[model samples]
Target: MPGLAGTERKNIAPGLAVSIVLKQDQRTGKLTEGVVKDILTKSPHHPHGIKVRLETGEVGRVKEIHDEE
Candidate 1:
């Protein structure tokens, strides 16, 4: 718990439950379930998208966000 001192984070504003699709192969349409671990934003010149870290340790980008139920 060395880094736990300042690791406390508050709830994200406008946050809601969301389900992301994890596609292993978009060509074949193969996909799996994913859990959003963190949301990362890119620089202004680095394109535009939200990076999501799945519970399965898979990291990818999503063009848009969706609400689930």
Candidate 2:
């Protein structure tokens, strides 16, 4: 997570429609959102970060993982 916090880019979430920032895993394309459901760093495609399903029930990868502001 070094050199990531100062990117000036906000994290993303499901249902918020985001552009692919960086695709760590083509199988699980990375996405950046302005809003999200549950944000957490888990063991998945992106060992860095991932966003959970919102009220809409959708899960996706977060190029940048940050709490809701």
Candidate 3:
């Protein structure tokens, strides 16, 4: 599937491209795209979104995952 990454812990992995909402941007719902550097959320699922750190060192909650074509 293309661009199908989700909030489930299993859906996110290191190196995958994804869009995330930084803590500061939650109100505006801005999405930042980057490769997954680390998965910060340890739960199986999250209502808002799984927290992750991008390769650029920006930390945020996964809002949308980008599919690498």
RMSD per candidate (Å) reads 11.3, 7.3, 1.9
**Candidate 1 TM-score, C-alpha based:** 0.39
Better of 2 and 3 by lDDT: 3
TM-score of every prediction relative to native: 0.39, 0.31, 0.90
By TM-score, the candidates rank as: 3, 1, 2
Q: What lDDT does the true structure give each of the candidates? A: 0.39, 0.42, 0.88
Q: Write the per-residue lDDT of candidate 1 for residues 1-69, one digit (tens) a residue.
A: 121111112211124223333445445534344555665433322232244566566655443343353
lDDT of 1: 0.39
Q: Evaluated with lDDT, which candidate comes out highest? A: 3
Error of 2 at 45 (Å): 13
Question: Using TM-score as the measure, which candidate wins?
Answer: 3
Q: Compared to the true structure, candidate 2 yields what TM-score?
A: 0.31
- In model 3, the Cα lDDT at residue 67 comes to 64
Q: Which ten residues in a row have the lowest lDDT in candidate 3?
A: 1-10
Clashes of 3: 0
Q: What CA RMSD would candidate 1 show?
A: 11.3
User: Could you give candidate 2's per-residue lDDT for residues 1-69 as a string of tens digits?
Assistant: 433431222333344433223344546654544444554444334543444444444444445444334
Clash tally, candidates in order:
0, 1, 0
> Which residue pairs of candidate 1 clash?
none
Off by over 4 Å in 1: 1-32, 42-48
